[model samples]
Target: MSPLFPALRTADEKEALRFGEHALSYAELAGAAGALAGRLAGAGRVAVWATPTLETAVGVVAALLAGVPAVPLNPKTGERELAHILADSAPSAVLAAPGDLLPPALAALTRIDVVATAGAADLSAAEPDAAEPDDTESPALIVYTSGTTGPPKGAVLPRRAISGTLDALAEVWAWTPDDVLVHALPLFHVHGLILGVLGPLRRGGSVRHLGRFSVEGVARELTAGATMLFGVPTMYHRIAEALDTDRELAKALAGARLLVSGSAALPVHDHRRIAAATGRTVIERYGMTETLMNTSVRVDGEPRPGTVGVPLPDVELRLADESDGIGEIQVRGPNLFSGYLNRPDATAAAFTEDGWFRTGDMASLDADGYVRIVGRKATDLIKSGGYKIGAGEIENALLDHPGVREAAVTGEPDADLGERIVAWVVPADPQSPPTPEELAGHVAAQLSPHKRPRTVRFLEALPRNDMGKIMKRALGNGNG
Candidate 1:
């Protein structure tokens, strides 16, 4: 269903989002969302598909402003995937292209909201009613995550779910109207929606969102004065590669106000190298779909190499481990989601009897409060011969190797050792694959023998979803 975009209470005149040749003012974006929201105001549930480009970005902001729960989905998806989401969601309608991603026979998608072409819909959607919405807070989104089930589960995020994120960042990472963000990440994920768009937009900053990430395109946008940058490790690796042939572009990226890396673990080598190459640390942060983001490296202080920095404001973190002090991470805060949509059993399983939301991530807290995420609580790690091996740490170490460009480490069952480290990597050059022995040797020197990958396979690129998360399930099942 189409959502009405709300007008920004504090909007900047200079900063505008450029989607292809078309550029929309803050008012226009708000208007589009308002138009969508107008239609969705009565029904109250909508799923949007416009890619991460200009049109979709506007649509999301509008939904939130209208106080309607708008779900952003991967555009590349077909009727099968969309059908599952719509059937489960029971949205009022779907605001999408003529051949929308959703399956037929699902509810919502009425004549009022459905449009003929890709042309921009009017600011007024629905019955053009002027009934002011209540200050009510229910589910604002049904954010689906990378789960075991073939059909993804949606995390129910409320209006208050995103406030703590902005407040926490403000307490540490300074944001202002002068700042302009280069948002190339997908909108389907929490990072792109909450931090990428909402965070900057809330602070009255401009976001130059791209339909898809392109190194040269992003570099050019930065050169044009986009100040903030945030991306996953793979995106940064590509940025680093682009900077090599385009030194000027690298210089441009170095000029940003703040640079951050998240969504997936950012390799330390890539983190430092990108910083050295572009003159920015690209502060690494830790978060998940359940909790928007709890930890991030400081802008002024030393961003500890492996850690995802300290907990954000209102977020309390502690390790559940008794021995090594590294187990599952537990968080308590407003930024956390209410629960899974229509999945009461899952919601009950998500948290302890206490209020704290049980983040599936495994991490260790330091004396200074900095937290380093090791792995997921449920099967994202390998323990071979009594030594724990996290996919993130090994993958980060692998990417540090000059020949390796992208890598994903997963555990395979072994009789002798409960689980052994197995890595699937994408070399910078396909023809010149990094030798398994050489890669293993590099990891062995850096990590313990148990932590070292027992087997390595070279591929063109790692399997990833629209949000840029490495699909380990795909790899484990050989689907990747």
Candidate 2:
């Protein structure tokens, strides 16, 4: 097999990466990462402090060049969560940018400060101690999941999983080296690091990170020749809100080749608004930590407003335990992670006897085979009055209401109904918020009466994780 980053081996002096003001050519990046790879020889596994910077990118690339599995640590992680992650994925060393004041949890490990322009050797020649380039099955990364229910478990991703997902995306999105992608997503998650950073590198393309997401930053990069844009629902929502007043933002978006939203379902309201303003339909894709990517709305196909398009080239996907169409999404594909690190029992339980990995996300396929994600089986699926309801649809319906700015849907215990639908809303006009009756009627009219929320609670904002997914479990009685 060819090397993971063919561009790095070339004498191409073209700009390969840019983070804020820092830039690196393919030759410069190759030299820096190669020198670091040589230093990382014999390392079992290294933990990278994932900040949104060039150093973080170089560090992970160096680890990959050395064929050592790199575990990325979220910079904003709390002390408790950080301690738990360290204990769970015990690494021999930690990689971070120079002068970063690391937390106490990382003090026990050896620190390797990553420098962007310190090396002088190209990475075309393999280090004597590094693993062979064809070792596709070797563990390349150990990413930890958000432990919403329990402690976070490490998902062991192999070299092939990274390459396979990127290549499939390149085909479906018509991605090429000419495409210069832009985004301000965090580096720890798959959407940000693997897709945002590694995706461009694998395609021999360029990526310009915003360092921090802002309407101005997005406009600056896209107007400056970035061909593609990546973002979560929250970032897009802000763009949708600003489009009417920000002509530059709208113009920039209209000029781009593609606008992709992932990590959470983009509200149909925002999707429609952006498209109407800029004439660019924002496409959506579906994937999780365990599976890097499964399905996407193909560039060649019609842009379905709500569906996540069809399965990628080699992925086999099916619905399990169907009821009225919606069911748990299960997939088997080369892009899947090997297993949960150190948890053989959990790994075994995560898949079916037939080897299809259970994604736990609930979705239904359209007549033409497009995938529409409903919600997760654990929290978003609500059984109300004998009907299995997906909260995502209801949430989207609520978002369409002019009075509602933000929304989350969940289920609560009820004596009459097995589970009653509850809507947690942040009002567009808090002073004179729409009555619960109005919101309920709006949802019922859009969908069915049974799907309407039996209880409507108002809040300033719905709780969200770093990736911008609404934390439905956090919406309890007192909070709203």
**lDDT (CA) for every model shown?**
0.71, 0.90
Off by over 4 Å in 1: 1-7, 10-16, 97-108, 111-136, 428-434, 477-480
Task: List model 2 lDDT by residue over 1-480, tens digit each.
Answer: 127777876736788889988888887787777778888877889999999999999899989988888999999999999998888888999999889999999999999998785334454543533553567889999999998879899999999999999999999999999999999999999999999999999888999999999999999999999999999999999999999899999999999999999999999999999999999999999999999999999988899888899999999999999989999999998999999999999999999999999999999999999999999998999998999999999999999999999999999888889899999999999999999999999999999999999989999888899989888778874345
289-320: candidate 1 lDDT, tens digit per residue: 88887888878768677788887877888777
What ranges in model 2 sit over 4 Å off? 118-133, 477-480
TM-scores, each model vs. reference:
0.88, 0.97
